[model samples]
Target: MSDTESNSSNRQTGIATALQHPQPFEESTIFDEYREIMTRSHEQQRQIYSEFKAFTDDVASWVKAASQFDNFRSRKRIKTRLEWIKAKHGEIEGVRREVVTCVEAVRAALSMLGGITRSLKGFSGIVKDEFDGGNDSDLQEPRSVDCAGPNQACAK
Candidate 1:
C-alpha cells in the first residue's frame, strides 16, 4: 500500500477505513496494545533474567565455599571419596559455565525488547517522514523526561 493510503483514511473509497491521519507521537490502540504487551513482556523477562542472575551468583558462591572446604579438609585414606569430590567439582564448574551462558542469552533477549521499541517508534517516524522527506536528524534527537517539567517524553 502507498504511504498515503497506509497513513490516512481513504474517505472516498467507501470501505471501512483502517488508517487514521498520522501525527507525531499520535497513539493507536493497536500500537498501544502492542507497546503494553511488549513492555509487560520485557518487564517479566527482566525479572526472570534477574532471578537467573541471582541463582547463578548463589551457585558461584556455593562453588567458592565448596572449594574452600576442599582446601582445608585434611587428606585421608578415602581415595574413592576424594576422587568423587574432584569429579563433582569439575561438574559444578561445567554447570556454572552453562548458567553464565544462560544469563547472557536472557540479557540479549531483554536487549531485543528495546530494539523492538526502537523499530516500532521508527516505523511511526518513517510514516511521518514521508510528508516532509527532509533531513532526519530530528528523528535522532534525544527526548528527555524531566518529572518536574510539564512535558515528560522519553528521548529516542
Candidate 2:
C-alpha cells in the first residue's frame, strides 16, 4: 500500500477506536452557571417581595391611624378627608396586587426554564446512545460521486 493509503487507514482505525469508547459526559459549567444565576434571581425576587410587603403594611397602618383623626375635625371636613384617604388607599392596594402578580409570573417562568433544562439533558443521552451504536463507519472515509456532465457541481 502507498504511504497516503496507509496513513488514511491508521486514522480511520483511530477514529473507530475512539468512537467505541466514548468519554462520559460531565456536568457542563454552563448548567452550573445558569443554576447559580437563577438562584440569585430568586433571592432578589424574595427580597423585593419582602420589602414591598413591608412598605404596603406600613401604608395600611398609616391609613388606619389617620382614621382616628375624625374626632378632631368638623364632620364635613372629616368626610372630605376620609374620601381622599380612601382613594389613595385604593391606589396603593392596586399597586400591591400588581407587584404580587409580577412576582408570581417570575416564579412560573423560572419553573418552566428548569423543566426545559431537564428535558434537554435527557435528550442528550438519547443522542449519545444513537452515536454509540456502531454507526462510526460513516466517519471512516469520504464517498466519491460522479459529476461528469455539463452543469454538474462537485461537492466536497
Candidate 3:
C-alpha cells in the first residue's frame, strides 16, 4: 500500500503509530534500552517470587512454632517454648522487612517501564506523518525491485 494509506490504516486501526517499524536486522539504542528495561523487569519478577516464597516459608515456621508452643504449654514446658516463640517472632519481623523491600522493587520496575514508554514517544516514536503526510520529502522513492518478470532491474 501507499505510505499515506498505510499510515492512515495504522491510525484507524489503532494497531500502531506512524513510526517506521524497524526490520529484524535493524537496531537502535532506544530498542536496546527497551530490551534492558524488560530484562530487568523479568529479573525483578523472579526476585519478587523468590522473596514471596521465603515469606511463605517463614510464615509456616511461625505457625509451626505457635502450634508447638500450645503443646509445650500443656506439657508444662512453657519456658523453653516461650524462648523459641520469641525467636520466631523476630524472624517474622525480618519477613515484614523483606515484604517492604519487594514492594519497593516492584515500584522501581514499574517506574522504569513508564520512563521507557515515555522515551518511546519521542524521536524514534510517533511522527507528524502518522497524523498527516508531513515532510516525506526526505524519504526515498520506492524503487522497482528485481522481480523475476521481464522488466526487472537486474536484467543480467
Candidate 4:
C-alpha cells in the first residue's frame, strides 16, 4: 500500500475503535463532595438574598412612614437613627457587613457553579452515545484507544 493509503486505514480503524468504546460518566467521591458544597452554597445564597431584601424593605418603609407623618420631631428622630456609625453601640453596622460578605460569597459560588455546569454539558452526550444500541452488557470494562503512539500526536 502507498503511504497515503496506510495513513487513511489507520485513521479509519482508530475512529471505529473510539466509537465502539466510549467511556461512561463516573462521578468520583471528590466530585460528590464538591457538588454537596455547591448545593449548600446555593441554598445559603437564597436565604441571604431574602434577609438582605427584608432589611432593605424595612428601611424603605421607615422612610416612607417618616415622610408621611405630620410630626416633625418624629421624622427627625427616624432619619437620625438611619444614619449609622460602625464605632457606635449598635448591631446594624455589623449585620450590614455580614450581608456584604454573604453577597460576595454568593457571587463566588455562582462562578464555581458556572464552571461545573460547563463541564457537565460537555459530558452530557457521553452516556447517551455509550449506550445507544450498543454495549449489550451491564458491566462492560472501560477501554481506551490511542490513535497516536505516546506524544507523537503533539505538534510541538
Model 4 per-residue lDDT at 60? 100
Better of 1 and 2 by lDDT: 2
Q: Positional deviation of 62 in candidate 1, in angstroms?
A: 0.2
Model 2 poorest ten-residue lDDT run: 122-131
TM-score for every candidate vs. truth? Answer: 0.31, 0.30, 0.30, 0.28
Q: Candidate 3, 140: how far from true, in Å?
A: 99
The Cα error of candidate 1 at residue 89, in Å, is 35
Give lDDT tens digits, candidate 4, residues 12-115: 99999999999886779779999999999999999999999999999999998887785787778877776644346468778878877876676567554332
Pull out the clashing pairs in model 1: 143-155
Which has the better lDDT: candidate 2, or candidate 3? 2
Q: Model 2 TM-score? A: 0.30
lDDT of each: 0.62, 0.68, 0.64, 0.64
After superposition, the stretches of candidate 4 with alpha carbons farther than 4 Å from their true spots are: 1-27, 70-156
Candidate 3 collision pairs = none
Q: What TM-score would candidate 1 get against the native? A: 0.31
Check candidate 2 and list the clashing pairs: none
Model 3: number of clashes?
0
Off by over 4 Å in 3: 1-30, 77-156
